[model samples]
Target: MTKLLFIEASPRKENSYSSQVANEFLESYKAANPEDEIERLPLFETELAPLGMEGANQKMENIMKLMTTGSGIEPEGEWAGVMKEIERLKSADKVLLSAPMWNYSIPYRLKHWIDLVVQVGASVMVNEKFEYIGQITDRPLQMILASGSPYENRFPLESDGTKTDFERAYLDHIFRFLGFTDIRLIRVMPTGMPGPQLDEIVANAKKEAKEAAKAF
Candidate 1:
C-alpha cells in the first residue's frame, strides 16, 4: 500500500478554492486505490518547531560532524522536531500539496514547514565537488494551486518588472531540489472573477483534478 502525504497549506478550509479542488483529487484517488494510506497534514493547525539560533547551530554541527567524522549525530531538543518532519517526507511514497496564492507567493506556514524539513544531511547533502545533492528521490508530487488573479499570461514576469506568480514556480523548484522527478500541477485561476465565471473555472479544475488523481 502506498503512503500518500497530503499537505494542506490553506487555512480557509472549505472556502479555499485550492482545498476544494484538492478534495476532489483525494476522493478520486481514494476510490481508485482503496487500500492506500493517506495522511493529511494541515500546516495551519500543525505545531511546527521553529528553527531558531539553537536549531541553526545544531544543523550546522550535524553537517560538520558528518563531513569530518563520516557520521552525523542524532538531533536533540527542538531540532528533533525538525528531523521528525524530514523523516515523514522521506517515508512518504507520494505527496500532494494544496496551496492558495498569497500576494503572488505561498503562505508563511507552508514556507516555515519547508524550511524545517529541507535540511542538510537530512533531505539534502553536498558532494565532495561542492555540488548540492538532494537526498530524497523518486517520489511523485502533485500540487493544486489557486490564484486570485490570472497570473499565467504574465508568468515569470509582471508589468512592473518584478517576478510574478511565485506560488507554483517556487514550489516546483523547491520540490525538484529535493529530487522529486514526477511532479504534476492542477491550477485554478482568476478566482477574483465574480459570478458564474469563477464557478465554471472551479468546476473545470475539479474535473481536471479527478482525472489526474485516477493515474496518480
Candidate 2:
C-alpha cells in the first residue's frame, strides 16, 4: 500500500476553497482505494514555533544522534514538538499539499513546517563528488492552491511582489530540491473577484479535484 500524506496549509477552515476541494478529492481517492495508507495533517491546527538559536543547536544535536544510531531522535528545545512532524514527511510515499495564497505568498505556518521538515540528510544530501544526492521521497508531489487575486497573469519582479506566483515556484522548487521530479499544481484563482467569476472558479476547482482523485 502507498502512504499518502495530505498537508493542509490553509488557515481558513470553512470558507477555504482549497480545503473544500482537497476534501472532495480525498474522499473520492479513499473510496477508490480503500486499502491505501492515508493521513491528513492540518498545519493551521498545529503550533509551528519559529527557529531560534537554541532550537537550531538542539536540532543539530538530534541530527548527530540520528547519524550515529541510525534511529530517530527528538531534541529538547523549541523544536521538540515539530520533530514528529518532520518524521511523518520522511515516511510518506506520496504528498499532497493544499494552501491558500496569502499576500502573494505561502502562510507562515506552512513555511515553518517546511523549515522543520526539509533537513540535510533526510530530504537532501551532498555527495562526496560535490554533486547533490536528493533524498526526497520517490513519489508524486501535488499542490492545491487558492488565490484571492490573479497573480498568475503578472510577471514576478523582485521589487514588487504583487506579480509573483509564490505557490508554484516556492513549493515546486522545494519538492524538486528533495528529488520529486513530478509535480501537479491545481489552482482556484481570483477568488476575491465578485459575481459569477467566483462560482466559475470554484466549479472548475471541483472538476479538477475530481479528475485528480483518479491519479492520486
* lDDT value, residue 197 of candidate 1: 95
In candidate 2, how many clashes are counted? Answer: 0
Best by TM-score: 1
In the range 1-216, model 2's lDDT, one tens digit per residue, is 788999999877768999988887888788888888988888889766667887777667666776677654554566665566666887888888899887777898888888877766555665668666667656888788888776653346687544577666788888788788878878888888868979988888888888888877
Regions more than 4 Å wrong, model 2? 59-83, 153-155, 158-161
Clashing pairs in 1: none
**Lowest summed lDDT over 10 consecutive residues: which window, candidate 2?**
153-162
| Ten-residue region with minimum lDDT total, candidate 1 | 153-162
Per-candidate Cα lDDT values, in order, are 0.90, 0.78
Clashing pairs in 2: none
lDDT for each residue of candidate 1 in 47-142, tens digit (9 for 90 to 100):
988899989999999999989998887879878989999999988999999999998799999999999988878788889998878888988999
Model 2 alpha-carbon miss at residue 196, Å? 1.7
